[model samples]
Target chain A: MNTTATLSRIFAGIQPELDQVDALFQERATSGLAILNSASMHALASPGKRLRTALTLLAGKLNHYDFGKLLQLSVAFEMVHLATLIHDDIIDEAATRRGNPTVNALWGDKIAILLGDYYLAKTSGLIAEIENPRIDHLFADTVATVCEGTIMEMMTSGRADLTVETYFEKIKNKTACLIAACSKGGAILSDATDEQVEFLHSYGLNLGIAFQIIDDILDYTEDQSTIGKPAGNDLRQGMVTLPLIFALQEASQNGHQQQVQALLNSDEHNEKDILEVVDWVTHGYGVDLSLQEAHNYANKAREALYHFPASSDRDVLDELIDFVISRRR
Target chain B: MNTTATLSRIFAGIQPELDQVDALFQERATSGLAILNSASMHALASPGKRLRTALTLLAGKLNHYDFGKLLQLSVAFEMVHLATLIHDDIIDEAATRRGNPTVNALWGDKIAILLGDYYLAKTSGLIAEIENPRIDHLFADTVATVCEGTIMEMMTSGRADLTVETYFEKIKNKTACLIAACSKGGAILSDATDEQVEFLHSYGLNLGIAFQIIDDILDYTEDQSTIGKPAGNDLRQGMVTLPLIFALQEASQNGHQQQVQALLNSDEHNEKDILEVVDWVTHGYGVDLSLQEAHNYANKAREALYHFPASSDRDVLDELIDFVISRRR
Candidate 1:
């Protein structure tokens, strides 16, 4: 089977799991403490693509794991992701997310902080009910890794001189660790063999890296409205992702280093500067190279799953890789 | 054994466990994560009396339980408590806690929120390592309860008309639940009877309420240096605690309702207004009444331990009740 139908089937399997997220929230969250319900529900409304949850469910289905366990892990993984978002908004002082006011924006930092705590607490409660220490430890460790990744991001912000090695470490922590854990967690629950778990782990890590690189690419290529945040928002905040890093490198070679430095040193950078950087990165032929790198990672992600039995699930996995590389935003 | 000697032994048992807290930080926390590490350590240094941890150890010892289980529960309880403080500081916009600058104050709300998340993630990790599912579930549920309490506190802030019943619910979530859980968790890990666990739960709940009431009282009576925060800090933020509830009751009888209304209504609430409210509350015998309630709770807390065997551990538990009523800050 070709990749398109495969992805459609993967999306189909994810639908019911998304539905289960609400029920899990209600069951694990009824503390009878006031305002908690409202804050929690409000946070759940944040318009994320539910990427990590989808990854978990799709990976589990591809491995032919139990739907019940997959649903539980999907909810747990989503809660962890949501918890991170709640904290991130506070850090960024961001008022709007997904084109809506953030939790911190609506309620203030105090409530936002408490709500993040609430999400993690509820996540722990839900995961604990699973009654498997192995799963519990994996989930907990992933949370630690995510924290370490976030700390790296916080420290590295504003450093134009950040190395490519440091950049990969940050993305691996912030983006890939949880994604990898989602599949590893699914495989662990299904009692998959070590080789099967490792395969998915590799697939998840590579795909996650490719996914973030695509996100960085989109920062230059997409409209702000389409992205729900400003284009080059990361650059404005001093976060130099791959495309910007590559753009700076090319600009230096063309003896336009002063122009690039002037943009970074400006009192107020505007869209013109952003567009200039984008043109340099794209028109200079760096986009081809960056896209090639992304394709290589996506291809590596697919190759990691070659050990799996040839089934419809594996076909769906291949489609996900294609989707990862081709998606616009 | 008298209260002083009993309290001494409990403190002695907690000393080693307190040392363990340092190791927990040093191992799980990365040194290179400077902001995260500094904020965490700053919060940890001169930690809050280790009351919850002491209670866990004392409860276990009184029941003739092993020390190892109590130590784990103590660490878990303390971690949970510290995590809540990090989040609470964000909610309160608090500048200081335990006489030190708050995480939010020192780092900013962003780092505070992330650090709080990290502590909670670590707590879940530690708890998941222990084999008992009952204890695991209890930790998770307690977190949810604490979040509920924090949310209620946030919702009620700047709400001068908040009732005493509402205050009770808030304290139950914010303070009592985890304190209650610490004792109950210790008992669960040991061979304590079901009745024994109930006794400890009741004792902890009452003691937690009493402890908070005394804290509220001190908010009016204590010197600024001793309290660390300024007196009437809660009232400045428009919080109506127990003393205010009682004073409002008495103000109604003296036909000085207009004066009371002016105090509550003034947009220019300054040090004078704060001092005058404190005077009015103390003048109307409200402070004494609040203290009386605290004493009643102390008595009830002691009664909860009557089911336990006669031992110094039980005596320490008893003295802890007295300490709740006697603490100056």
Candidate 2:
């Protein structure tokens, strides 16, 4: 099966919830102003795989989380995700996303930025409708953490001193925090015990870390057409991700440290040089080491499921851990 | 007393609460990233009159709202306001605010935009701490409305077809809604009856409407250096305000239709012609009519307090209405 079909298989149990989220997006991503309405509809027209929403739904399987409330959280989480992507496009100066022109590309940075703010406002408003204080605080704090993480990443870009700990911390804030919130939110909505809630949080945390590491790896391994961005785009933008971090450590003894350091120090890099760097990182034990890290986190994520009784939901969630590490893009 | 002293006097009863809000700002505007932390601190270093926070404090007097809770709401509201202003400075291409360089000026549009989002996330997180769903909903809904209003304003900016009604609607969404939320939030935090909450809403609504119109009027009547921007800057930015709307109609009736039309259609406008348009608008019943409108709303704001029993809070609130109309800045 193709990636989309395989992912759909993984999320099959939440198909109905996903459909409701689509309807919710159609109904809610609107404004009286023409420009805002158009910008929102355009952004909504194409979306990333609804993995975060599915996380919320899947986390609800055992607790029998109220479908309506879960759906609201799902939609809100997705919107916040989309808003961040839109903002990220501006920050990345990305020309496209998922093979479509980015909002920033189509509407310019100003409107793109405002529309992102609008979506965030809508997300917070949606979250406010949920009355549980824990869920309320979780999403809000997660939003703050996510922005802080991005800012921190921006601050750290181009620096040679990026530690493994700093990389993990940044990813946790930027990527893993929202995913963890999604999991915790589902449990908080249900009748789950505190222990159950903690399990899901840890599950999401590890899964998100693995997921981002894979994305970073894909920057080296995947083709530009498939990834919808230039290969090594992260490196070109002065971002040092997991794969590169590992490669740099290896390069210290492997005699490629000078090559990697040259790329990092200079503001220029040709496509050929980028490809060669990718080869050095990917072939010279970089991908293997990064994959090793990804699997470690993925394994830890699966281990969190040990808290719950065996069931089909657990089986698929367990399967999702592998799916995260294996996905190409 | 000067405007600042008079306003301080009006807020005298809530001085302690306001001081707590200041402390809260200092405590909360920090971030892990030095850039974000410094940016937030710089934005907070000079704040406009804390009128909205005072409204929250004043509204709480009747129900004896918890000081701690009110402080959270106050800080959140002020941050949201500051976030909007930061975003607005980018939109307006403003160089300075309150005689200090704007965040956009200091750090460029990208940082300013993200910092605005940062402040907003901070606001949402702060509000989430307040367990009252009504207050939560109020702030969230107000944020969306404020953004919508701004988009509407941007869309309507250069258009000659801007109606008085549209202007009212835009200002209500952009300005009045937040102010109303400030008032209603205070009441919500307190144990006020539904009727009292509604009155506070109305009071803020009218006061906010008057506040914006006076702001618009000041654009034309205030000195270029004293106002910290060029006189008639709003018209230059293609912003159609109350005074301009009145002036336009007067210009049309006085057979200056061609002159006004030329000004609207052509981007080129010498300072001489801009000053002349100001003369037509301000001298020909613009300021008077605008002031009249301001007083009308200010009076209605006072009328909302008719239901409240006489108290020191009520007295200060009544005086604040006058302050809205008569303040030079």
Candidate 3:
């Protein structure tokens, strides 16, 4: 399958931006660097797509805010995201992350928890050091929102009858809020107008949904080794994802409701049983519909970027729509 | 034995201040109140000397600054402290606190952790609302430091030879820093002069040290029924307190170091054996001397407040010095 050309283009464009972000993290993260080196290094060196940081950089550049601090803002958002994952692993009792022993698995829950707090506190301190109280306020509020979102997610876990609306609420808080904060924060740092910030926020919000949906999709389809996690980990944990949401509805009407429910409740499902469910969704038009929904979100994100003046940055952000919807890994 | 009349006066002074602090907690702790209410209420209802809040208010009033939002700070710090205890119970595998089932024992460690995070986030949000970024900065740093301190305490838990210097550093961060922050933050909020703020910080620091030493003393002298925790808990956990530090040094010089070390390292020590050591210390001159050292610290704490204007608030502050050291339950 052909990868999105825009992915490479955006990657090339943000190389300088990534270097600046690394430098800023190095400068501010000195006090506890030696202590936190293992956890922090593992978190930073993970080979994520860097979609969130790219959004911040592109959003800032689109608003004519070309500066070094955008990279810092990118790193700040990424660090916040990393901190959440560290805590999430503890909550999830996850053993392996990105193909390595989880922090809690290696260092125990206490250190993992403290390391997460350290990163969060360090992020706030770095923001405060920028001498911009506005940024500090927004960053603190965003982190608080992230915590609230996590609480909500925990509150909803193990509920089989959770609605799509509630799921939207969870994902909005869990993922979109920070993505929106990233774009909005970047725009604000660039002194973008309120309308521009709002637009970028909407863009990031929709993009985040698409990104998370793709993550859910990849859980079923990607190589577990490459993904650094087991396949169907969410379903094993009883997490209802987009495909399950759609398939359950379809199966209910098709007289396979009991079968689908049995599969969900059963821990003994063999590979063949799982493959049947995956095949049913992949061949029955649900996969196309789900991907199309992600594309629609990408389109909305592109529309949001139109509010800004046209620039190569804006064009790159527009291409992100295609990049997000089409990426295979 | 008659307790100090000065402590009774300080308790009376804190009654009104506590009402104010309780109201602030009630006003701001909107969400998770139902889940947290029992723990928070238990903490609120379970009586401590309320010395920290008294120090906060007294420091403000002594500097002739209005106690603007200082009550909120008081509630936040105390709640944060309580939250740590809840999580600490889980880490320590404790079942009871203040003669009641701990949050972890009652609701389980999972809930305890989330509830702890909830309160911590609430405290952060509350501190952010204090209209001064400097105080917020200090509050955030103090929380991180406290976590670091506890983590260090846990890391060095089983070691019998933990240094006096390291123990001082840990207690300073875990217990004293917050107390010092409360005093300094109150003074800062009240527009106290630099010298006055410094004086309050020193007072709080010295008081915190004395407070902790007294706590250590009570662990040996007080009964389990009165203390609401097992007597000699710290020693049972192999923690090196001031008395143990003193006894160990004395034992070392007397060539009985191995005996003391063997007692601490013993996998099996009945309550009788435990009390034998306790009785030896109490009947020995070492315990009295250690307590005398604690009293010395308390006197120095009162001395730190001596330079302030001699108002009733200052008198209440002086009374608090005796009350903290006098705690038996």
Candidate 4:
């Protein structure tokens, strides 16, 4: 099945709740100021796949499934995801995201920065409404981890010697931690047992790892029309992701290491150089190896479901792992 | 007395606790990444006056005087203050703060932005340790208000027809709200009565208004050597603070309104035009009228303290009002 159909199938159970989440998010994003309101509405218009929202809602389904609390949690998580994307666009100097102009591109960095902070503050207020200290602490720690991960990526940019361990660490912090928080937080909101929360956390963490690994792989294999960014965009930005790391490891033994290193080390890389490296990573075993690793985590995510009894909710979560692995974008 | 001696007298009771707050801040700022660690340390090195921290500590003195909780609140407030300053420097395109290079100046805006987010995240974690839902909501709402105020300021920049009421609203949101949070939070931590909290909040709100007005006044009156920046810096940046607003009002009666409006509406302000406006505001009734407004607020702050019984803490808090109004810088 195609990505859209698969997501539709997976999200069918919680579609109403998801809509409510969107509604709440829109309400919160609206400000009295014209500029702020317009910029926020623009950001809200080009929504992502809402994977985190789905995760939160689906995780809540395993137990009590309190829609009120679950809706708030989903909206807060989505706001955080959007806020990070706004700031990330500023850092990347990105003109567009998901085929739309970024907040930083439409407005300016100053306004974009403040808008991101506003979303975060809104998230805090929403979490406080939940009246759960544990959730508050978890969300706080996750944001800090996300900041650290992004900093690590910025600091390690252009370094060809980045280890696979550091790559996992960085992606885990940048992406997986928040995804894990979504599931864990949802489970906590439903008053799930510690064991149940642990299992859901594990499932989300592994799924998130697979999700990001696929994202990195698409940077090599997919075109701009499909991926919403040019192929080899990551390489051009000096981000050494999983495929590039694997390709570099293989290139060191195959005598292509020096050429790649020179390109990475240079202040300005030509488009041709980037395409050449993209060809090597895509045509070689790098893409295949990375996909294999993504499947490994996907399987681990599936395994985590065994702890819960058979239910339609578990089935949707189970299918989500496959959707995460198979999606093109 | 000199500013130093006055502050020393006020802080004598809480000096040890202030030192502990500083120590804890340093430890939290130390990161594993070299670039992040160094950038954070550079920001930490040039500490601000810690007005928020002092407010938190002094307010806590009214009731329980719980050092542990007050310390956490104090540090968190200080971090929030510093984080806003870092982002503010980016918005201002400022190169130096407190006669030291800004994070943006030293490490670029991207790093500065991340560092600011990092501090805010740390603040969330600290507030979580306190485990108070009300405080959490307060901090979050205050942060959102601060962002809104900043966005309002940016949107209204260079508008010569800005109203006095709008100026008051902007300053209250951008400055007074957070300062008010510090006192309110400290009161909450120390188990003060709701009435006491309200009084402290009033004290903070009024003092904050007076503080910002004096700051605006100093921008026109003090030279670079005294104020750590050039005179008329706000006017040069098209800020339209209280003094300038008052001057614009006065200028309309004297037939100089059109000339000042041209300077404000221009895309780029030359030094001479800025100095001319600064001279008019300082030499005319603008400064005196603005000072009277500040004193009105300062007196309100003092009146708020009448509800509290006599204590050294009350004395210190009262003395702070004089220190705020009289300081040259």
Who wins the TM-score comparison? 4
Clashing residue pairs in candidate 3 are none
Model 2, span A1-329: residue lDDT tens: 55678888888877888999888976777877788878878888775548888888888876776888888898889888888888889988888887889999998887887788888898887888878788777877888888888888887888655788999999999999999888888888887899999999999999999999999999888877677777778888888888887888877644565566667778767778778887888787778898999999998898897688998888888888988888876
On a 0 to 100 scale, what is the lDDT of residue A290 in model 2?
89
lDDT of 2 by residue, B1-329 (tens): 55667777778777877888998987887876889888988888774649988988888876666888888999999999998999889988888886899999998887887888888988988898888899888987898999898888887887765778999999999999999998889998998989999999999999999999999999998876667777888878888899878766765454565565567677777778888888778888878888889999998998997679998888888888888888877
The predicted structure with the larger lDDT, 2 or 3, is 2
B214-270, model 1: which lDDT tens digit per residue? 888988887676766777777876677888878877666445545545555676887
* Per-model DockQ: 0.71, 0.70, 0.38, 0.84
Model 1 clash pairs are A110-B91
Q: Pick the candidate with the highest lDDT.
A: 4
Query: Per-residue lDDT tens digits of candidate 4, residues A100-210?
Result: 999998898999999998888888888889888888898899999999999988988887778899999999999999999999999999989999999999999999999
What is the clash tally of candidate 2?
Answer: 0
User: Cα deviation of B259 in candidate 2 (Å)?
Assistant: 4.0
Better of 1 and 2 by TM-score: 2
Using DockQ as the measure, which candidate wins? 4
TM-score of each: 0.92, 0.96, 0.89, 0.97
Chain A vs native chain A, TM-score per candidate = 0.89, 0.95, 0.88, 0.97
